[model samples]
Target: MGLDFDWTDEERAYRARIRDFLRRELPPEWGDIARHGPGSKEQTDFSRTFCPKLAEAGLLVPHWPAEWGGADRPTWEHFILGEEMWASGEPRGAQYMNVNWIGPTLMRYGSDEQKQRYIPPMAKGQAIWCQGFSEPNAGSDLAALRTRAVRDGDDYVINGTKIWTSYAGLAETCFLLARTGGADTGKAGIAIFLVPMDTPGVEVRAIPSLIGHGDIHECFFTDVRVPASSRLGAEGEAWSIIRYSLANERVGIPRYELSARVLEEMVEDLKQQGRFDDPAIQIRAGEAAAACEAARLLTYRVVDQKARGGAPGPEANVARFAVVTADNSVTDFGLDFLPDFFSGLNRPGYLAHHERAIVAGIAAGAAEIQLNLIAHRFLDLPKVAS
Candidate 1:
């Protein structure tokens, strides 16, 4: 049977409803706050009020099971929700992590007590969380992280620092990974932890960057102690759990939707300036739009796989690579045609898209890593010997 590219009537109605909710609820100054980026205090603070409203409207966690505050909605609806939210500059802020992958990961791997303590807040859109994966030396090579979690009686003492941690400054909890095995144990020895950010010895310092205020951070875990109950799963099980989490995360953000919106705005700006008649500009815009559509289609394939209950594989890597390319393509087109917008605060949406596009390849996972995965897994290429 051939694939159907059209959305069903019900799906179209669902998307329209979400759009109506956003049109009615978002403040006029939302564009200003959104320009500061999703991890900025301005946006995160807004999410505290905005997301609860989304939950109240049955729009926040619709894909989650009914027992977990959702209506047991289809996976496609979750993706539709994501596309609309992202297109509107993601007013959910850092809480999108809670809605996308973190809450579901916890539901899958967390214990009864852990789920009871965390998942409810997430479902209600009240929780903010940061991923504690990247470090100064580890970046894309997550298996090489050196943070240690040493057990002491019923508690584990965590030490070492994480860099480039988004929302670290404002998050109440951290989905942390630390080594529990010997020095040379690598990926096999790592374990996942749910540590409260307020726990003593946990220090978060903002990292100065062009991304946004309070966006990237350096999180120092100095002898931070948490009970063994905080561990999500058995030691050495982190890799599998992380894989599942990353699969959800890789395709979760509909960044291409935002990119396409930005591209359209750029076209409109050019048209207003009478530059739309330029064939060169039109060609470049068409290429950028094509990239955005390509990324969207690739991402849809991954979402389709998830909807069919198929485990995510190298297709996720391929889709992620396309997304990064699409982000860069639109941002580059904007910079080439509309340099003035990048200089001032007048075009906050363009500025926001530019900033996010700069790091799209590096965040989530590096573009190089995705290419490596696609090479080996998707392309079935042999690895080069060191």
Candidate 2:
């Protein structure tokens, strides 16, 4: 028989509960939007109403410990929840920091109070957190960031600008990394702080993305002050914590349900155009179908390993690489159906696979970075001219 990673009867029941909640609590319009969901910047903003409701339903942070307001379910349960939500084409309502990134990273490395103060509100959706990691000068080379923070009595004053801050304009706090030691401290001087969004001298400006969403912003901090007690873990250890969290962030294995919805729509469009029998288009569509299924399996494999307490290692990158390709391929196939009769020339359909493909390469990690990681870390390739 084929490999069976079927959920237990109890797990199945739990999923049904989540499904019922989604049906009752989520906006009715969300069902269709959940599939073929917004990839645009404007659309990426999780519906504000749904986020707090998700928190109320105990669905936002299932992977967290009970002390942190999570349901404390096993990892497989978390996967099931993700599957059900994605399968519904539910807009991913919770920001990653509250659900995955900073909270867990904090639980792993934060002082007890830091965890106590930050995690619960995040899980409850009473607070929204933005990541302050990337900068114009320090994206792929993140350690080169020039943001500075200095000690003054018990308070740390921060001054820096962070770009590509997803949803910062709407966030209530930021998991900010700043040069606590000095500009020359390299990665060693970095410290992670949970800074309130309303802190004086902090500024947020929406930045335009290809998808034209307010979801991405540029967050600026000028002399922002916070007590040192707000720091996550100890001074100078932020490098490891951030790295560990990001590894899991990238490991947020993609599900094909969303792409499958895209495929279904494309097929309908093709049928309407009376070109459903086109051999080349049929072949392309078939390839996308196979790729999407394969990507889903790769993602589930990672979940299986983690459910049993295994680490998400290098193999997890396979999911990121493959699924992105699958999404792009599916998009390419669908966009080809754009009718030429409107202006006597064909134009791209906004919802077509092609539109998604162009942006697929940018999400999570760029393809080049993923390949480099696989090469050096997985393949054990020797570094050049170090």
Which of the numbered candidates is closest to the native, going by highest TM-score?
A: 1
Tell how far residue 374 is off in model 2, in angstroms. 0.6
Off by over 4 Å in 1: none
**lDDT at 47, model 1:** 97
Best-fitting candidate, scored by lDDT: 1
Candidate 2: list runs displaced more than 4 Å.
1-3, 31-48, 92-96, 182-185, 253-255, 339-360
Q: Indicate the TM-score of model 2.
A: 0.86
Tell me the deviation in Å of residue 129 in model 2.
Answer: 1.3
Model 2 lDDT at residue 32: 39
TM-scores of the candidates are: 0.99, 0.86
Candidate 2, residue 316: Cα displacement in angstroms equals 2.7
lDDT string, candidate 2, 1-386, tens digits? 24466768999898898889877876655533432324333334544556677777778777788877886789877777766765554455435445656778878887888877777777766666678888878875667888888899999999989987766776777888888786787999888888889999999998765433455678889999899898887789988887777667665535466677667777777788898898888898899899888878887777777777777777667777777877876766655654342221342233433434554566556777778888887788887885
